[model samples]
Target: MTAQKKCPVCGKPAEIEFRPFCSKRCADVDLGRWFNESYVVPEPIDPETVIADDGEGDETIH
Candidate 1:
């Protein structure tokens, strides 16, 4: 037998429709985190490793 995964939001049993989430609310909550910039991957990009922007835009720090 296989164990079911719990919802990352509320630790409830995940529904098939929601997959990793228990419901649309939980799924939306997760998405909200992304939309609100609550989720981030702290990867220190070296300045030399970054490519310069070809478009007309303000200078961005690496």
Candidate 2:
């Protein structure tokens, strides 16, 4: 049998509609965290990489 997933915000059993969260309130709370900058996605870029804008408004690696 598959184990039920718990809500990341409140540690409650996740509901089918919410999928990963228990309720709309929990979902909204998670969104609020993202808007408030509490959650961030990491982006790594190489400093040696150079991108130049072509005349046609497209970016090209020079």
Give per-residue CA lDDT, model 2, range 1-62, as digits (tens).
65799999999999989979999999999989888784454555655554443457645655
**Residue 43, model 2: Cα distance from true site in angstroms:** 15
**Per-prediction TM-score:** 0.56, 0.56
- Please write out the lDDT profile of model 1 over residues 1-62, one tens digit for every residue: 55789999999999888989999999999999887775565777878668665777775755
**Total backbone clashes of model 2?**
0
Provide the overall lDDT of each model, using Cα atoms, as 2-decimal numbers.
Answer: 0.85, 0.81
- Which portions of model 1 miss their true places by more than 4 Å? 38-62
Instruction: Give lDDT for model 2.
Output: 0.81
